[model samples]
Target: MKYPSLKNYINGQFVASNSARTIKVVSPVDGALLSEVTMSSAEDLNDAVEAARIAFHKWSKTPIKERVQVFFRYKFLLEKNLQELATICSEENGKTMSEAIAEIEKCIELTEFATSLPQIVTGEVLEVSKGIECRTEHVPLGVVASIVPFNFPSMVPNWTIPNAIALGNCMILKPSEKVPVSSGRIAELLKEAGLPDGVFNIVHGDIEIVEAICDHPGIEAVSFVGSTKVAKLVYQRATNNYKRCLALGGAKNHLMVMPDAIATMTAQNVVASMSGCAGQRCMAASAMVGVGPIDHIIDKICDEARKVVPGENLGAVINKESKDRIEKYITEAEQQGAKILVDGRGAKVDGKGGGTYVGPTVIDHVTPDMAVAKEEIFGPVISIMRTNTVDEALAIENANPYGNAASVFTQNGGVARYIIERASAGMIGVNVGVPVPREPFSFGGWNESRFGVGDITGKSSIEFWTKLKKSTIKWNPEAGVNWMS
Candidate 1:
């Protein structure tokens, strides 16, 4: 039970900030204070940014092969300390040990994919018209700020920081206030793995520090993951300052049960998607669009959902306010004529735990106007709607304002092909529940669920880290500015 008292990581060292204040990291399972992380204010943020700026010139000029070596070393260190780090994730984030481990594994996969970034951050050699050959090169954005969310502290940071760093850039991390300890451990591991100072810096604060990052002139770009409202604000503010931004916003994922889909398989996938992480995932299948076996599938999904008991250590919503809001949403939905079909609501949670627990509340007869269906509850509540035809299901999927990810379970290849083409979301799963963590593939949302042009974890991650300058090099071995003229 000996956990390190966390401090902000700056200039390759863990240091106490000017404020010297700490935010106690609490276990959502029992509300017990697990660890204390040093709280960084605007001053600390400025310090980290300044450090990254100072280190940027040297780090970005380093050889790509040498950079790859550091990433390899970091990967090794993570493997060595996987259990300890994952424990911190589970303790603070309240995910099950298994889920936490999987989260770490996914991050490891991303790191492995990013290992080739040194080489894969490649340039293109092109043959244009006549003897004039054109070439394009990829270069790093100077100082980037990555704002990570609480749900996947370690995993998302892998998405945010690795590609940026691999491309010879200095990255400043604004990890979730709820789980900064996990990120502190990551910073510690990266240092052990031999990254240079200022190349990786951690600044901790709520929204104030994040806003400062969005507007910081010294910062060249920003990457973010959070709610849609915040994502839009961050993207707008950053782009307004002429900065590169990759903002992943909120999601209202849909799971469609096509008639051709096997009933039992659909039920299993739905349960895994909705119940896993206690439905706290942004990509969790919150809305079920019923088709093929519309009525029959809802019954199966509801039955499987009923068995998902609210238990201690299963994890709670982030905090008390989150818990209250989720519960209120369920009640309001019920009042709005959505039937509270089955109760997964855990009883009075022990205050020793975060007391932010909401049991799985399943609602049927849900309408578009109902709170449960309309709002992204960010809890273990599932809403079921029946659509008779495939077109109707696809229509329901598209009608949602937030379009992060969507899935259709079907055996018919034609139907699968049609829905995937028609469904308007970033990630789609034909028979899969959650189609996240597919490394080397771009993951993003359309509509309100995402902002900015670059997606993370796929082809877009590479695009996000590097900038392309279309060099129309009209070569006469002569003038440079004259080419533009």
Candidate 2:
């Protein structure tokens, strides 16, 4: 099927890039072309940045109430077209309908949260001394960029956009070339919400565009979500250019099961977390750390893993490259002496031309030093490691390089508390598999999993997109009398 040609949304309008080169966005579900988008170049980036810079001068001065009203209207528009956005996510990103809807719902939740920007962007006022008052306010940064990933076409961009724009900053969003459709839809909704031209813009391209965003002087800040390698490059380049960057990276989040935890229930939760979205989420548990008598736990996990059929019960990974990488990791793990308790390497999909499917795979007796155990295998595969004690499990979790999230399945309060206190992960889950925080709190990781001081979403996002200024004033009768006084 020939899908419509997609263009970049720049200066509040959809336009073709200066470069005639285009890339096909292929669906991971059936390897079919969903659409084709322009391969944007540095010139396109310059245009978007210039537009955002021009718009920021006026938009930043707009009243806070008026800006919030735009967000309110944007929230309504998002809700109205929720299904359409979700459908686009499913078509291009290869997530199931329900999963895509959930992602869109998260975007809506962020929009709703942003409508309360008045309260969120509130400043502090204090009487420092007699007749002296000090106040602080957060002012918007200019022409911030949100470089989002294909795994979350809608939600991740919302993490930066609504909050950034609500705080009165203009945005230049560079959506993933693999799934650029939803971002254009979002830009359309922002326009309908009365956002000014260039207040919200979309640029579509690959690394050159990203480098443009980093190197351009007009872009004051950037928010990104992707693999660790790319996140490091983005962070380094943006920071070196003196731009504020929030680059969230990859992870190998572990799900620790103690002796007292119910094996069957823990297995169920582990399987769900490992298989959901084909384990593309950064918080997905890539390893299961078992403490004491782990045979039964491993068996339960294997049984649960076998029940998940990719492209049927669970969706495929993002693309053929992702599928091939996952299979390679599984094979390498087996060759390196890890036992494959549940093999998903041979999983198949009917009528999908060997779609990007990797069923739930569980490997047992994996050591902490194994490459598969140490790396972030963003697929539906879980590695099992046996530890003699809870301390050992905690040590393993903490010693890992990526500290995105950690989970412990235990009814005992002590063990759960112990893991919570010592896991060294940014997000901790007790009896929960995926511990992604909600809109009220920021999402971040420690160690190599994240880069930058502030995380994405919540109040952190508000602070990241804005700069603080403090004012000190005194009401004195002789105010004009003496600057020296």
Best by lDDT: 2
Q: What is the lDDT of every predicted structure here?
A: 0.80, 0.88
Model 2 agreement with the true structure over 122-241: per-residue lDDT tens digits: 799996765677899999988899999988999999998888998999898999999988887888888899999989988898998999999999899999999999999999999999
lDDT string for model 1 (368-406, tens) is: 667677678888878887767888888778888898999
The TM-score values for the models, in the order shown, are 0.93, 0.97
Give candidate 1 regions above 4 Å deviation: 1-5, 20-22, 127-132, 348-355, 469-485
Residue 170, candidate 1: C-alpha displacement in angstroms = 0.2
